[model samples]
Target chain A: MNALLEAQGLHLRFGAVRALDDVALSIWPGEVVAIVGESGSGKSSLLRVLAGMQRADAGQVLYRDAAGATHSILDASDAALRRLMRSDWGFVHQNARDALRMEVSAGGNVGERLMAAGNRHYGNIREVAAHWLERVEMDPARIDETPKNFSGGMQQRLQIARTLVTSPRLVFMDEPTGGLDVSVQAKLLDLIRGLVADLGLAVLLVTHDIAAARLLAHRIMVMRHGQVVEEGLTDRVLDDPRHPYTQLLVSSVLAA
Target chain B: MIVLHTEALAKSFTLHLQGGVSIPVLRDVELTLRAGECVALAGPSGAGKSTLMRCLYGNYGADSGRILLRHEGAMIDIAAADARVMRAVRRDTLGYVSQFLRVIPRVPTLDIVAEPMRARGVAPDEARARAAALLTRLNMPPALHGLPPATFSGGEQQRVNLARGFAAGHPVLLLDEPTASLDAANAEVVIALIAEAKAAGCAIIGIFHDTAVRQRVADRLFQILPVYEPA
Candidate 1:
């Protein structure tokens, strides 16, 4: 697999707290890398830095498109990163509404990504939105209703549709099934696994669920206290955890 | 014990596009909630869960139905209550956290979280103190208390919304997907807070499709039929 994205020696800080220290991550084309950690373990900070929301103190994030050209995201300006997000990258938060506009119709939210990509015709937007909504298991008729009226899980699904509709090459999902029930989480994880495989898009998944990591990730990187402690093939790491922190995390899930 | 009850509650909107076309949004539905209870609404999109909730909160007018709130002696006709009366009722009685609309530009995070107390006539100093306490409970720092919520991330903003709804000290607190985007750890804290608020005599009506949240807070689960086929 080709290295589609890479992060090298990334260092981040929030005030005096060391959020990320000499962190490194790399994503191959059509591979899902799960970054797993405890609550204060700096998983979110790393994702934010890579996504260009927060600037890292040092190091670099490099992306190599299919053309063999490498782009350094760490040095890119905010405007340049946003332009990249518009066409080539997708980011999904744990909450769907944050990634969406609530006041507008649900169709508008999905179509807006297309709009950002320059599709302005309402009919075309509605058509693509409905098609994607069906793919995400939402009602096509309610496509006209505002997201405020949609259930929590439904809204999240709408968000996934919005992101996937753009057909971006790389996507970042932060605990996509975080607040959902086990049954729903299972279903959504399955849906995501299938979609990521079918789309053949590279993914960087940050999550707390070990089961989710086992299911979706090609490789797992265990983090603790703002650092990566263990990294390897997910099944091997989960089956035979070398790091003590990875053992603790795997054991807690087992003991539960 | 049934503090809130709706009979055949229905609401619909006319969706007028380029051509003056009309469409029905919500069908006639029924719902009930008792004192100190939390219920979860689960269904696919366009199932009218949000429309039903808006009517219950009196934000949207119900087309045809009876909404009665159980008072000390009798059931008050909430549907018939005047605007001023409804405003007063909402002030002291209800708390709400919608899915979005959480960001209050230029207002400090702590101030926005404490706006509920101010609305209910809590003193300025007391409200600020209370807001600080609320943020502390959510594990947010004191420094963030003075900064605008617009500066926070999605997870942080959701926590602000959660703290505001849970700590408002109202009889009825309504939350729409309060933890929808929160991670497992944050979601667990939010669920515990919801149960804590419920134990404190607050009637909670929250909508969630997450099974974990439903299992955590929903004493009685309302299994509405999904409008779409299961994925």
Candidate 2:
């Protein structure tokens, strides 16, 4: 099977700090690959590089379209990348406030994606937005309420709903459940798991939470000092991590 | 037909806190199971029975071997299967019932049992109905169906775990001391469940310490010999 996105020899540096170094990964359709590390481990940098939000100092990132055409993400024009983002890719930021229009109504936040994707019928857009609100476990009655009025968890859910309303083939999620209360985090994780499975969406997730990566990712990459120290099946990597750094990272997590 | 087997499977644990001493558990263990057969793992304590089970279930990675199983009409090595493949295998081909229930707080007993079925795409109502039937067969009353199993007795919780394990009807099932907490009557219920599963051509590997239960449910015994090192 052709990979939906592939990156090789990814290298990025800020001053003397190597944010990404020789990182390579391939995400297949419907697969969830998580990049995990402590803060400043280049996990987020890898995500940004792959998603075209940030450029790598060196490397090739190839995106295979549904028609089997390969496009170089690094060399793609800004307009081309924007079209892909609006049509085939979705990015969920760590902070909902970063992704959402806080002042816009919840329904509009979701509807805006469909509009960007060329949906013009007002009633159809509203109906689709309402369905997505319910899909994310939010009440459709809150369609008119601004996301600023919702709790952090609810705002995150709205962000997810907006990102997924267009049913993009591949999604970039950077700690989607980060900054939420533990209980709310679990609920959001459950919702994300369900939607990802139901839609068969391919995902590249960056998280420092080992437990969340285990729960959602099919595969895992462990990073340290901007280098991938280990990569393997999520359970195998967590249960019997071969790399010393990965072992320490796994052992440090407090057992639930 | 052979459903699962292991080849030269080995595992060891490193005591990093204790001067990095390594203790080997299983070494070159070979085992096989066929459909409609129940092979009970037999051995004394510390014979690496649990370790072998964990390796087979992918809870512990194999040090140097393969856990080959027939999944989706193909032989796949569980030792090397990525999480996506393992998840699909667990959903449609393999099932495990641990000794204790990993209780999900606030989830009702019926939902707990029905969850595996739901993951396999079974309708919610149908899955719940099957869960209720299995729970009832194990002597769980309808009155307790809506309540969480967290506060239930050990035997009741084990029954819930067993119901969930058997609910998905996976072709291969692993039971780790499945009836440890159950009473005589509940043990009888488990024995009957095993018989029914075997009759339906389900392949089972289990650890039953109770000789009577083992004799009744297991078609054969696979001994796990401990690897003793020179001290």
Candidate 3:
């Protein structure tokens, strides 16, 4: 109850192809909900819709704010939506390049969110950027370096630092650890997991990795054909899947 | 009255690469939520739970359904609203704390935490004061407040993340694994925050992998059934 976001009768299409159809879901404050499916299962498409990164042909998306007010995200203006992204919400791209300004220095990346909000003290901005670097396990000395010079993992870390610096209440992520090596992914996962909990964040993570879902999400939603086939608590879904598709999915992961 | 509810929600996907193979991702999902409730969503790997969440957040468009909410004495259906209406809803009604924290590079942890307040027209000094207080409550060391939180440890950065989430004091919160890589102590701190939020009448939805934590916080469970039965 006391809901934060709600979607009903969502419909979308690309040419003759339907990307989303009659999808519904809700998020309360302080919740982590994961969307899991195969690569073609429309997981990314769904995340994009919820984050307002894409437009739907039909249906509605409603959002409730901290002030106990509700608005329709589907009906929001570009400027209003942009403001939401800048203040009340945050989005984490699967690829750091999609989210970060690759040319910006690590410090500038973090400080710019503050600058956008009107903080003018250059010294303070750099100081804070260096601090965030330390928090994400990057070398503070690299704060002046551009993401182009950093390793994939470090670039991802910098991206996270940039997005999280403003502390938006809602965050949308798409395969946050997808492109990294296993070792790098593991480290990033650890960082993500820790930060998520500490913040009591509400997340919608899209991934095909069962382990990632198991380690990070509180509730898991399995998708097939752009529709939800199964969903429930993470443990119960993974351990005692009910739907036959769910059973197969779980077993396959276990077998893997 | 339910704080949030959905009826007859459905969604599908069409793959272009395979000559537009149509895939049904969600079909006829019905859900209801109340304040101070933490409901856990469960299902198979590809069941569209994430899609459903996105739909709820207005990220994904729905085919047909009603996402109804009781807010400030009016009922609104999010599924069919316009862009302007949706933006207002986002600003005052919903708060989503995502899996990863993304900031503008080089912003101090304090300013990042304070940015929300500043947007609301709170004075810079006042917003920073509140941010500092929240950081302290979350156990962030004072020294880190002035820093960027970029290079800190995972636990430390997450604390800053938490500080920012709480800074807004939103009524409804969305979480994705609020305690993933954290050591026991940090996880406990998050758990306490969740408890506090729930007690304060904030409704919460979350994706949690930690069974103990899920059991500790969730008020009930919701399940989504896969669309097509396996052969």
Candidate 4:
């Protein structure tokens, strides 16, 4: 099967820094590709390029949503890109504060996505947002409250609910479990893994934790200094060390 | 080791916009959070997550019940604490990150982050240096530090908020849903930094919706209930 979202020979730079250089990868339908890297390794730059926030200095990101429509993310106009983001693609940020409009309540945050997709009925929006909130382990009462009142974990969940409420086809998540504690992280990862599997949505997850990649990704790609050092099935890469960086990452969690 | 406590913590809003009408945003709620542990409050739209946080932070007073803060050598009855006490606690012991850009309009980014230090009477030169270090940790560009934060991107603005919240050396940090706008990669960077801060012994309280974010950082979790109908 052809890859749903594919990148070829991608390169991005900011004066002295080569954020992404000659990077290539692909994701088939319902695939989870974990991009792992250390700090300053261009993990985010790659996601940004794929999301069409920053125009790539070189290369292309080819993506196809569930409806079998394909487009180049980097080539679309602002309106076209916005429409796609609103309807087909959902981006989950690491921080709940940035992903939501703080000025509005939690219901508004989730409802805005629905409105963007043309759901104007307040009653319907509330019902859908409530259901998603519960799935993400949130109470419906806090929907009127801004994320300010809740804990860090809840904010991230709200962000997920806001996007997933629309049932997006592809989600780009950057370190979904970065700041959360172990128990909460466990429950959340379980939720995400289950949700993705059930919905069959393709996901691109970015994280630095090898364990996270092992647990959530179908395949893992290790990035160092703005380029992919190694890429393969998660279990295979974990079982046999191919790249030096991969070696360092996997050995840390070894049973022996 | 409890840093903040809410007993029967209840709040309500009376938005009399249309001919003596009232809106009860929150209702009977109770919460207690200890130091060194992160907690997540999960709820749907109108569930009162933000309302609870604001009431705790003293953004708005709860209509009834009591909010208590217990710190080393200082215990506060948050409900009755005067503005002076609140200011002192907020300055020396509290760090807050709201969902939106909370920085002063047109203020240089450096000053915004370093505002806490300046508030605590730190020297101007030293505060600037502290701001620089925090900004660097958050991956903010050095050159952008001198400009007013209003011109910065949403990510940078939030970074500035985080910097300001932490720069004060406050023991308890409060964040209102900090990562709803960033792409995945930048989101990771911010969340990782929050973890580092917590490990450094800052009592961090954050509001978030991303399950992964909550699961990764929270030590305890609560579901803040809301009153669907206002009386």
Candidate 5:
């Protein structure tokens, strides 16, 4: 199958820092690819560039739609990019509060996404919001409550609900379970894994924790100094790392 | 000794707009709760489970019932208690986590969770510290602690509500759908918190729709069937 998304020779920089250098990757439909590296290794910058949240200095990021039309994310108009973000793509932030509206009710937050897709009926919108809340393991009774009333885990869960409510074909997640307790992270990983399998979504995930990547990603890309040093099947990479850096990364996690 | 007991609790509503139609929600319910007891109420939707909890919490008036509570060396009937007495009971003896969180806007979540302890005359610093501890255990991010919960997601709001209710260590606690909005991980934390509360000798009455949660926390089960009468 043709890849659902592809990035070729992508490059980005911040002053003297080369945030991403000649990064190239592809994600097939119903696949999960995780980008793993240490802090400032350019994994996040690469993800941001691919997700169209940041502009790259050079390279092409192409998304092949379900209809087989390839669209260049960098060349797409702002309105077109916004529509894609609202309808066909999702981004899950490490800090959920940054992605959610702090002043809106829980129902309003989810319902707004539906409204953006042209749903206008109040009853219908609220019903879908409630359904998404329950799907995310949240109580629908607090639909009128705000995100500020929620704990970190619940906020993250709600953020997932908000993003997935539209059933986007592709999702970009940045450390979805970071800053959570070990036990909480474990459960969240299970939820994410289940949802990804059920929805058949193509996902590009960025995380420093190898365990999370191992659990959720089908393919793993190890990055160092703004370049992908190694890439392969998740189990293969973890079980037998060819790159020395990949070996060190895996061993460091085990040592910790 | 039973810390709380309800004798033949009954409730009905008259819908005047619907031509005075009488709807009986609860019928002659009897329950007994001892210290360190956790009882889960299980029932279908519209089965008066929440109505019974509301009645137990003194949020709804009972047409006929005896909600007796052992509070501060006195056995008080919450169903018949005056507003002032009920307020005192709620302040010092009862803690409730309703289906939704209701609060004034602009009060920070930390202070909101700390209010129960503050009401019991605990020092602000100590109460806040305890509140922070509970919030952390529930996996509430520290960055949002200073902000108000008025704009929080349903699940996040529920955690703050749970933290506030659990903070006080009230003698008699009522929880309605306590874990309904939480994921397995956060839900497990709540289970542990409930266990700790039970160990501390609190008497709990809760409605848990999640069977797993009920299985982990409940010592016994109470069934509330929907009450219907001849039209």
Candidate 6:
């Protein structure tokens, strides 16, 4: 039971602000670990650092591949990282506009990841892309439509389909349901939960919404001032928060 | 064989805003359940019945003692189980039916009931067929199966919740006033469901305020006494 991803002693600073302070976390295979806090709490920074998109001032990020070899993600060559991202890892951005190729058709957007993974058969790529679209509850008829014409929730679903089409074992999701209508967010969260379980994905999820975390995460880490104030089982942390900051954060969510 | 038990379980709530006043709800409470038995939690108001239920469900952290249940052929103390173990245990061994239906908005009733089965790796077609069968048994019309339960009446919503809870068919089940919102006929359906579950060797714990319902379904009564004290 080796950790799929592990980070230790992470410290990142921007001028006078400590973006991440001695943060440490691990995600096991097929596990969903949520990092939650208010804005500027460094949750997003930790996700980015763990995903190898951003460098921490000091820390060790270890990733164990399926072949049982552990690699230092922070020190990996850019080429190696790119190959890893295309094959073994997936990232879903908060804004679909940031993750999606707005000009590409939905099917092309999903097929690009397959192409990067070395799937050269055009018919197979299109078929797999259409299957992924259906898996995410999108209409296959819209596969030729560019994402720009889709609504916000539909675009996010398309982004998820594109990121997941290659069957990445580990995913880094930063506010996957952010900026959607409340009803849409709930539906999207349910879809994500089902897909994560179906695919057995190990996820590093960064979200400010406690309810979403409760619904999707197995464990929860509460951050404040770039430090983890509390971490435990999702229900335990939400129901019996030991840290004052975590308690305040949990209590502040308005009841729906 | 015993399916679940609690040993000297204790729980208390501290009010942070009320000058940190501590309210003891349960203290040294011991309870047990056997396969094919229904234990009804009986007590007056504020007697910690719901607290004990929540503790067993891992919604509330126990202050002390063990809430142990047989999971995967081993007696695991849920009070100390980590999130991963707890999730697995809940997925494979424990089931709960609360008084109301709480589901993601816009998820149709059939999918809501079938989702748990789908998570357990059941095929979509079979899971929906089972969910449809259960909902039909509970008198939910097929016309409403494609609609969400958000706008349903209280009794109708509870039926949906019950169907979802029972669809998983875990070895142990917890019912928190499951029939509180149901009519007499619906309550009868629930009694039958409980009987069928027990016949299949599922251990159950329930809180039923309706004495008739309790007498009909409960094999025994576990009384929970209040532990409140004035400061």
What C-alpha lDDT do the candidate models reach, one value each?
0.79, 0.92, 0.77, 0.78, 0.87, 0.92
Better of 1 and 4 by lDDT: 1
TM-score, chain B, each candidate: 0.89, 0.98, 0.86, 0.92, 0.97, 0.98
- What is the lDDT for A75 in model 2? 96
| Candidate 3 Cα errors over 4 Å, as ranges | A254-256, B1-231
Model 1 clashing residue pairs (backbone): A94-B181, A95-B181, A180-B210, A181-B210, A181-B211, A181-B212
What TM-score, computed on C-alpha atoms, does each candidate reach?
A: 0.52, 0.90, 0.54, 0.52, 0.53, 0.90
DockQ of each: 0.01, 0.40, 0.03, 0.01, 0.01, 0.40
Off by over 4 Å in 2: B15-19, B103-112, B118-128, B142-153
- Model 4 lDDT per residue over B35-127, tens place: 777878877867888777776766666678888887556667876764435656677877777887744434588877876798688998999
Error of 5 at A124 (Å): 1.3
Clash pairs for candidate 2: none
When only chain A is evaluated, what TM-score does every model earn?
A: 0.96, 0.99, 0.95, 0.94, 0.97, 0.99
Q: For candidate 2, lDDT tens digit of each residue in B1-231?
A: 999989999899875545677889999999999999999999999998988888888877788889999998988999888766787888899899999887755679999899889888899999999999999999999999999898999889999999999999999999999999998898988999999999999999999999989999999999998898878
Q: Report the lDDT tens digits of candidate 4 across residue range A1-256.
A: 5677888989999999999999998877767889998989999899888888889898988888666778898898999888888988889988878788888888888999999899989999999988888888899888889887878888888899998988787789988877898777767787787578567788999998787777678777889999899776565456544566766676667451
Of candidate 1 chain B, the 10-residue stretch with the lowest lDDT total is: B14-23
Worst 10 residues of 4 chain B by lDDT: B13-22
Provide the lDDT at B113 for model 3.
90
> In model 5, what lDDT does residue A122 have?
96
Q: Locate the minimum summed-lDDT window of 10 residues in model 3 chain B.
A: B82-91
Candidate 1, superposed: residue stretches over 4 Å from native: B1-231
lDDT of 6 by residue, B1-231 (tens): 998999999999876655777889999999999999999999998999988998998878898999999999999999998777888888889998877776666679999999889878899999999999999999999999999898999999999999998999999999999999988888899999999999999999999999999999999999999986755
Candidate 2 per-residue C-alpha lDDT over A156-253 given as tens digits, one digit per residue, 9 for 90 to 100:
99999999999899999999999999999988987898789778899999999998898888889999999999887787789777777887898899
